[model samples]
Target: MCELLGMSANVPTDICFSFTGLIQRGGNTGPHKDGWGITFYEGKGFRTFKDPQPSCDSKIAELVQNYPIKSRAVVSHIRQANRGQVNLENTHPFTRELWGRYWTFAHNGQLTDYQKLNTGHFRPVGETDSELSFCWLLQKLEQRFPEPPQDMEAMFAYVAECCDELRELGVYNMLLSDGEYVMTYCTNHLYWITRKAPFGKATLLDEDVTINFQEETTPNDVVSVVATQPLTGNETWHRMKPGEYNLFHFGERVGGNVDELADVAFAEAKPKSQAPTEPL
Candidate 1:
């Protein structure tokens, strides 16, 4: 299995702290160490990095830790190989051009009997089920809608349905984005947290470093972080229920139901949470 990390925010924010901790999990703290990657959205395009080495030791990961590449949306992954070989092409957050924009995705689950899906316009450069799934997802989206929909809720629902179908094959926990927003679905474990006006100090589970977010953020900042598991000890990370999906925009969950809102409050305390193989 692999691990996933994602972010959606109202303003450009750095992922340094969380990412540094996550990198440790890629080799030092946990088993997901075959490869690692991260993506930062800058308007319609992205700045991405990937390597076929444990994040804890990868030179690229070190650069990521030192670089302050901030973005409104980001996605990252660290892998523990199962279906794919340990190679550059097999790494993730996979990307493809769809609907005239770059779409990125990362997954952390295995898919049994998943070879039946079709990937018309979208194709995989990597030989991984996760990559295949991304291509298939994009293909379906194009078949259903020739252009981006103005009704985002409807669009989200459609995305959920497509994700659900993928789940029928096997575990399909994933994070998806097209620069504007992020769509997260759970097949096993995932968690999320949003930092706002009352930002506070938080420490990483894998590293000794602690960040006092209030000192680095503005009063108007609204940044949300999603991961396979809770990174900090204090925040209440909400777990998305099985067979559930969430849409985030401007650092907050949209289309909130009461139960879902409660879940968000609890997201940081929950189970868990990638972006592509290609270096950029």
Candidate 2:
């Protein structure tokens, strides 16, 4: 299995605080030490940092922790290597170009018969089931809509349906983004928390670090974080149901497969938290 971390913010924000806790799990506080990678979306383009070494010890990981690369949407993963060999190409947070946009994907679980899934034109560069699944998904989307769909909510719903089919094979927790919106699907474990005005202090669960977000954010900032597990013990993270799917844009939960009531509840929820402040 692997661990996933993602962010969608109204303003460009850095994920240093949450990332610091996640990296510690790569070899220190947790056992997902095979490799790790992170992608930060800046405008229409994005950049990624990957390493086959344990994130807790990798210098590259250290740089990402210290450097605040601000992004509107972010996807990151720490792997435990159940399917593929430990290497850079096999790292999580795989990327592909679709509809002239760079789409990033990361998976936290495994599948049994993923190789049977036809990828069509898109193909996997790595041996992991996660990569294969990602390619297959893109192929399907391309087949259905040669160009990007105008109805993004419908497109995201289709993605959730695809994820459901994949879950039939095995566990399929995932985070996917295309610089604008982040889509998440869960078959096992996934949690999320949104923060806005009147920010509060948060302490990391894996490390001895505390941050008072109020001192670092404006009154209008809205930021949402999604992860395989709660990164902070002090915050109240909403746990996604086993078969739930969610969609987020500009730090707000816009749509998903959940009932209308649940969607409304999330949309009208009070503002809650901050990521990091620094130039990209």
Candidate 3:
């Protein structure tokens, strides 16, 4: 298994605070220590960094923590090596060019009998089942739509359909983006939080660090973070149900199988801090 972290913002935003907690899980606070990688989508340009070493000890991870590269859509992953060797090629988040955009993908779960899917034009550069799934997903999309669809919602529905098929094989939680919108699918566990006006302080669950976002963000800024678990101890996070698919663009949720739940919508919801009880 693995863990995923993603960000979608109305304006360019840095994910240092959330990433700090996530990296700790890669080796320090959690067991997913095989490798880690992250991708940042800034306008039409993007940057990616990956390492086969444990994120808790990797100098590359340290540099990522200190660097404040801002972007609208970002995807990250920390792997536990369930289906691939511990190497850079096996690390996520994987990237490919599609529709003249840099599309990134990261998976947090494994699939059984995943080799049955056709790879089409996109081929896996790594031996991981995660990469196989990613290539297959893109192949399916390419076969269905030779060009980016004019109606984005229709495309989202198609992606959800593809995800549903994957879920039939095994756990299929994933995050995908193409500089425009971030699409997330949950087969078992995933959570998200959005920050807007009247920002507040948040303390990291994996470190003794705190940040007052009110001072760091303007009133008009809107930022959203999605992770396998809640990254902050003090913020209210929305838990995605099994079989849920959500899409966020420009920091605001625009499409999904479920209605977009605002930050306040989950204000009174109880925390799902207990280990996941749902079957994978």
Candidate 4:
């Protein structure tokens, strides 16, 4: 399976530290060595860097480590080939235009029987099930809304339904962003950590590097990071359960979904800490 990394923050922030740990997993720390790609969102503009080589040894990954390109939202992936060949076109973090906004998506799990899914306007340039699923998602959303929906809660609820349907095939853990918000869905393992004003020093789990986030951030800053696994051993990351989904905007969790929330006993099954931050 591939691995995913995403960030959403109230202020422009760089993901160098977390990325450092994640890149190691592409070869050194784990087995996701096929390719790697990352997309950073800065207002209406975005920048992406990718390589169809092991990120741990790729010079492009080294540049990403040293260069700081601050952004409010970011989507990154390191792949271990499953359905797609190890080529630049088959890389994750596939991008598409929807509702006049650039939407980026990355998946960490494989889907069986995904060829049955249909797409109208959205099409995949690669042979990966991940990209096929992404295209289907956007195509369905367009069919339902035509344009962006006015009722965001309803819109996301619909998104959750789509994800639930996708889960029928196989694991579907993914991260998606529309420049304004990030939506994360979990089918297996996924974790997140939010760093705020009272930030402290944390060490990477895969690397020996340590950094004091308090020194780099302002008092009002709030940044949230989501990864397929916890990137830092020192930080207490919240793990998402299977069949769960969360929406984040400006570093705050704004929405969550439970496919079977009607059951009172099951409603208390997972953590109920973060509240929705905005309408959308």
Top-scoring candidate (lDDT): 2
For 1-280, candidate 4 gives per-residue lDDT tens digits of 9899999999999999999989999999889999999999999778889999999999999999999989999999999999988999999899998888899999988899999999777878999999999999999999999977887767877887899999999999999997678888999978777778677777677777777787799989988888888776656677788888888888987888742223222111221222222201
TM-score of each candidate structure, all chains considered together: 0.92, 0.92, 0.93, 0.91
lDDT of each candidate versus the true structure: 0.82, 0.88, 0.86, 0.85
List residue ranges in candidate 2 displaced over 4 A.
Answer: 259-280
Report the C-alpha lDDT of model 1 over 1-280, residue by residue, as the tens digit: 8889999988899899999889989889899889999989999999889999999889989989998898999989999998879999899998778767888899989998778889886677868999999888888888888887678767777888888898899999999988778878888888877778777777677777767787799989998888888777666677777778888886987842226665554422321211111111
Clashes of 3: 0
lDDT of 1: 0.82
**Whole-model lDDT, model 4:** 0.85
Write model 2 residue lDDT over 187-272, tens digit each, in one string.
98888888887788776778877787888789899999998888876666777887798899989989876752452212222222
Off by over 4 Å in 3: 262-280
RMSD over all Cα atoms, model 3: 5.1
Q: Mind sharing the TM-score for model 3?
A: 0.93
| Candidate 4 Cα deviation (angstroms), residue 60 | 1.1
Question: Which consecutive 10 residues in model 2 have the weakest lDDT in total?
Answer: 263-272
Q: What TM value does model 1 have?
A: 0.92
Instruction: After the best TM-score superposition of candidate 4, give how far the Cα of residue 266 lies from its true spot, in angstroms.
Output: 22
**Model 2 / residue 256 / CA error / Å:** 1.0
Model 1, residue 224: C-alpha shift (Å): 0.7
